[model samples]
Target: MSTAVDTGGASDLTLRKEAVTASADNAPTAPEPAVGATRKEPPPEKPSDTRRRSWVVASFWIIVLFLGLPIWWHTTSIYRANLPLDRMLEWSDGKACRPVFPLRISLDPGSLQDQEAENLLRLTQHALDDLNDFPAHHLRLQLAQKEAKQGSDVALTIRLTPGESVHTATSSLHPHLPILDVSYPPNSIPTPMSSSSGLATYIAAQLRSNFAEEQNIINYLLESSTAHQEQRSKSVSQDVAQTLSKRVTRSLKYARTYHLTFSLFTNGPSPSSWDIESAIDQYMRPVLDMLAPIHNFTLDTQVQLYAAPGVQSQVLSKEDLSAFINAAEWPLSPSIGGAPTVNFVVYIGNQTIGTEAAETSQSWLIPQWGSVYLLAPPSSVHVASDTLKQPILTFTSHLLSLLGTPQSGSLPLRLSTLTRVRSADLLLRASSSLGSLARLSLALKSISIPSSVADGVAKSMHHLELACASLGNPESLEHAQIAEAEAERAFFEKSMVGQLYFPDEHKIAVYLPLLGPVGVPLVMGLLNELKAWRNRRRQKAKAA
Candidate 1:
């Protein structure tokens, strides 16, 4: 009975299995089990196609390397014009020029025999040489056969006259001329055989005294310059240097011409008219004429009635003095020319200086700019020339300082010294400019140097050479002027400075976006190709 039950159960199980299998098979045949679409095998690449692809990539790389790279390099490269940097540095260091002042002094031995005159000149020269510590400034003595000519190259003329007193000598400088009148005792005149004499020593001492300030100024300039370090004299003390520094700071730059603007500024409407033209003609004309050789002056006078002072206080302090000129309201605009403008302002006010020091005078020099005079309100509406006399004279004195004239010595001597100082000043300025340009070029490697800059440098160097060669002469002034102008032009080149603003980072920022996307594929393709080529070579070697 149990076997029959087990057989029945097995039959039922088989039936159930058959039913499940049939149900699955008959389910619409499942659309042949939905056979996946056969994937087609890719065709093998032809060697020629592979070679063509490689050639295309290689051509692209070649174009980039040979054409695109060169174009980019050429476009982006900084144009650096060839410059004589070494020569410029040499000039700045004073290795190129040595300045020497050969001052010629003429001797008029009136009433003395030629032999005695020559003897006196010889002894005087020897004494001068002995007394002179600076070798660059030399005084050469020559006998003036004629009446001392005016405005000659001779620095000074010594006119010797016989005096009744024995062993006594007196010297006086001619007010209008560069003549030194020396009255000597007959006994003081040196004999032909005399090696030395008291008169000679006295004359030498006097000349030294007369030129002491000039020597100090020259030494100061040399010391101030980068070049001529060894040529600087030890006689310039700290006090003198300080004074010179102040003076130099106050003095205007050297120029071929200067415009003189005399403005009469008044708080009230009264005294609107002034005799400025007459005052300038009478008081300032002589000085201007004297300065004609060194610089030209253009004068223009104006009267402003409603003008106001910068400081309203009646008592102007030292600080207030600097702001006294209402620069914004005043029509003191610089002249429209290469020449600088010097302003002479005569303000009609009753203001007094707070300090009683000499520096706090009613009229004060504004250093390089010009001068200002605080005048009391005029008694009349029309200012007279006499009323403007004091102010005009003050302006004249300030003008000399503005022109960088030496403080000491007579007018003629001061002017002579001014020439030398200006020459040295211009030379030093040019050299300094050259040095600055060279250093700038070195510092900014990517700055584009235009051909104009190179041309200007060349011109400057040429003019500097000429100036150096003709130092201590009037021709040097012209040469130095040209040199300074050229140097300044080169230094301030617009192109060179403009390039400085577009630095490497700026170029990168402008080019990165375009170059990055384009460069990546090219570089990666080349690298992959190179790697594949190396692997192929290795595989071929192994097969071999």
Candidate 2:
């Protein structure tokens, strides 16, 4: 019994001990507080530091506004000089210039007295005015006094004389001068107080006939210009307009001088030399001398050997003729001057034109450039002047067309017409150029206008004003030429086009790296300062 009780008590003590140990292991316990340990919080910002950060951001913004932006703008902005845009447009519209040609025809009564000559002049003037439909081109007849100079401002001088046949009048244009020689019957001459006579009517009709083509051409020019619609003449037919258009396109641009280059191109080196100088003097000098008043010509002759044509075919077609001039291989550069070069090529080749058209000629005129003559191979090493006669004549005719001379008229008359035509052309060209410049200025908002362009425009406008005032006179040609040159220079200013290639992306690429890093710090500082100020205000409100 004693042993059983002892065993049971020992078991009970062991169970109690195990249970207490387990309970102690599984039960939660409070952790002991550590010495010198506290919750972590951000350090309080100093007012000075805060103010410094605020000032840093403020200074950055100020620099951006006052210094950085201004520098950027100054570097990138285009310098546009002020221009008279309104005045330019106005000049282009042709409201500023009205062209009028008042031709003065002097009547020379060789054997008649002063009173008879005066009556004849008055009657001729009345008849001419009545016959003239175009007021722009009208003839004013004046009796030539005994002391009058030979070549005055008179467009034509009508010399009256007694003809063998009564009631018969013969009119002839002077080959060299601008004089019209008229032979009239003694009885046909208008006496004092005579209202009308056959001689007077005949002179008026003949004058009208001679100037009819000139009138048409002038009317065409005015019609083609930017003049008012009412100012345009309706007398030109569609066929005539088409013909005139071709002529205008085929003609060279007006210039004070033309470089005439006579080149003798040979396939082989045998016929290397040519008597081009003598040939030009014989055949072309007369016309050139007459054209001296309108344009000056400079002559240059060269011989090129072993010069190959552009095409290899023996028989050239009409289309092949254009490529005949080997511009790459040939040293046919323009003369070193302001004058345009007119190349007269006498290509020595056996190549024949294959065209079946009978109207086709061996020589052809290349509009605005020059004429090309395909000649047979010369028998000798040196080409004679006689052999070049045809070519020189052909060149002379082509030169007239190149000068924008009228097709139908004597050399003197054609040259006279050319002066007036050239003046009108230049005036219209200058006006058109001004219009283009104005439009370009308005179209390209970013294009820079240089001071040179402004100056050129001003000079062009000044010359244009002078040209308008003297539209019908020879002085107008000089003024119009200057105006055209100035206008062209202003329109094609090189500096205006340089900035077009600089894109905004290129500017951004250059500036973004520096601006990006600097801007981020500034913006973040400003944002943080605002947040801190808001937090302080909220805390103060809570405490209150």
What local lDDT score does residue 43 receive in model 1, on the 0 to 100 scale? 100
Per-residue lDDT over 200-294 for candidate 2, one digit per residue giving the tens place of the 0 to 100 score: 89999999999888878878887877454446556588888888889989999888988888999999987979998899889999888878877
Q: CA lDDT of each candidate?
A: 0.86, 0.84
Q: State how far residue 453 of model 1 sits from its true place (Å).
A: 1.2
- Per-candidate TM-scores read 0.88, 0.82
Deviation from native of the Cα of residue 375 in model 1, angstroms: 2.4
- Candidate 1, residues 1-544, lDDT tens digits: the string is 3553457888999999999999998887335544787878899667788788789899998999999999989987878999999988888888878777788888898988889888999999999999988866888888996754644577888888988778679998887777888988878877788889999999999898888888888898888785786886575889988998898898888888888889999999899799988998999899889889889888788889889888999888888988888888998857758678999999998887767564445887887788999999978898999999999999999999888888876798788788878887888889989988998888888887899999999999999889887766778888998999999999999877777677778878988999999999999998988887787789789999
Candidate 2 regions with alpha-carbon error over 4 angstroms:
1-50, 190-198, 267-272, 305-317, 326-334, 349-360, 376-379, 500-544
Report the number of the highest-lDDT candidate.
1
TM-score of structure candidate 1? 0.88
Error of 2 at 69 (Å): 2.0
